[model samples]
Target: MSSPRISVILPCYNEESYIANAIESVLNQSFTDFELIIVNDGSADNTLSIINGFEDSRIRVIDQENLGPGASRNNAMRIARGEYMMFLDGDDWYREDALEIAYREITQKDCDLTFYQMINYDDETGDIYENDWFNLTTLDELDGKVFGPEETPGSIFDLSVGVCQKIYKSSFLRKINAEFPEGIFFEDMPFFYYVYLKAKRISIIKEHLYFRRKHDASITHVVDGKFLDTVPAGQVLMRIFIENEWYEMYKFDLLAYKINGPRFALRYIEEKYKIALYELIKKDYTEIKSSQYYSDFLENLGPVKKKFFLDIIASRNYQDFIKLNS
Candidate 1:
């Protein structure tokens, strides 16, 4: 059998309430020649049953023990038979024309990847809002423009790290071995940087075609041990950068990313995890501090940003850090 032009990969975990809408959205896309790959990540609820209720042949369901989202996505990608790939969260749905527009633009542009605009839908209060966080619309000059990561250097970090907000050329992803890191939270951080850095061509869709659902139970609202996964996640990202020889070229952007992402994330996580998170951050920074690029990074940081890293390294414990911040 010939492969479809696009494959939609949806990884679900107990998304019984919203999976139906998610499935229906893809099955009803304006672009008809596509397959939907749903990974049931050991959903303990009626999610599997709900998924089974759908009688579409284009829908392929993979049942697996609850591996993290990273693992689920990897599994789906391995078996996905598509020229292009799109990721969808189980709780989110795409506009009917999303696939049609994205596929057309990507093909015409010959882009390895194309990201699009996403609006947030709050199920609790019925609030719908657009976030200008994705560089797609904010960088007006880049609208429908074909660009590459190496052309922008470290600015690759500036793009949205949300994997679901984009469509990927399956061949490019496969060629680059862009697989998600299992057993880590914020896996998308490293994964996004991984793919973007290796991408030869990237484009954007200015139209809002994806809906990101937000609710209390969402991972963003949770503060737990997994929050500390940001440290290891950052660690993995640092390794990718340094090993790829990007760390030296973009040390400033890389350090700033660490400070903004994992370091800053410490402020919101549970208090109990602070010491551990601190130690992890300190450990990573300590290694960087001794590296040859550390001085160069500090030079690029000016005064204020340099102090933040220094403060993290100099502090005896979280209390000292708090007192310094206070």
Candidate 2:
């Protein structure tokens, strides 16, 4: 009945088979002073029945109509009673020490947000993969190259945007009014960019404490959808950055757009929209001298992956790129 130090918010849809294991992973965590808030986002399956079977007082369940993951997470966050917050997806489970380790690191560093790495697992094939998604040169290296509130420009530079990997201070969350945008497929991209910019200090742990399951039903595994939708969603975030005069961040955004955005737009035009793929190419591909980041991105792309899009941009071979599209 005592107040908990951290509140773990989980948003569940139709995840009956997976929710129980996800909950148990937290309950069995080496760190136990945390409450679990599970939001059943209008599941037609047995997700609710399974959640109700849990007899723990620390587990609080909220039932609401299907409102997308972002809104569900925001709803739970509003009623969260912990000093710190962490997100655990319904279909994914955390390592026994994830929350424990993240809590310790955040407090020790006095960081507003502390994030770590993730190990991705394939549900069907049992294939396992791990990477330091943050691209941290060293996990043990901290305190140096730290960014102050004013010194660091806001950017879309991080490797992953899964909200679940980090622990956030409740006060800091309130200041930014941090909530994922609702009804969008790529909601986290915008949410992370905006919130990270507002934070006074941020930190990262180099260890992998989270296990991300790559299930076919999950949005992440739906490559076709992501390939089609991510760019448009990223474009919206780009506009938000530009309108705010965070010009320095544009380099990061442009890189993101070039790397992932074109695939989404091109996929949409080809499969669903049935529009001319050539026209989807930037009509005015003039250089924008905003920052070295952007210029560096172009230089990096010139000799790299020889895709139709790159060929068009690099060689001005619009005809060739268009021919490949056909």
- Residues 55-156 of candidate 2 have per-residue lDDT tens digits of 998999999999988899999999999989999989889999998998988787787887677788889999988765633433334433344435433334
Reference-based lDDT, residue 308, model 2: 39
Per-model lDDT: 0.86, 0.71
How does model 1 fare in lDDT? 0.86
In terms of lDDT, the poorest run of 10 residues in model 2 is 283-292
TM-score of 1: 0.93
User: TM-score for every candidate vs. truth?
Assistant: 0.93, 0.78
lDDT of 2 at 2: 66
lDDT of candidate 1 at residue 237, scale 0 to 100:
86
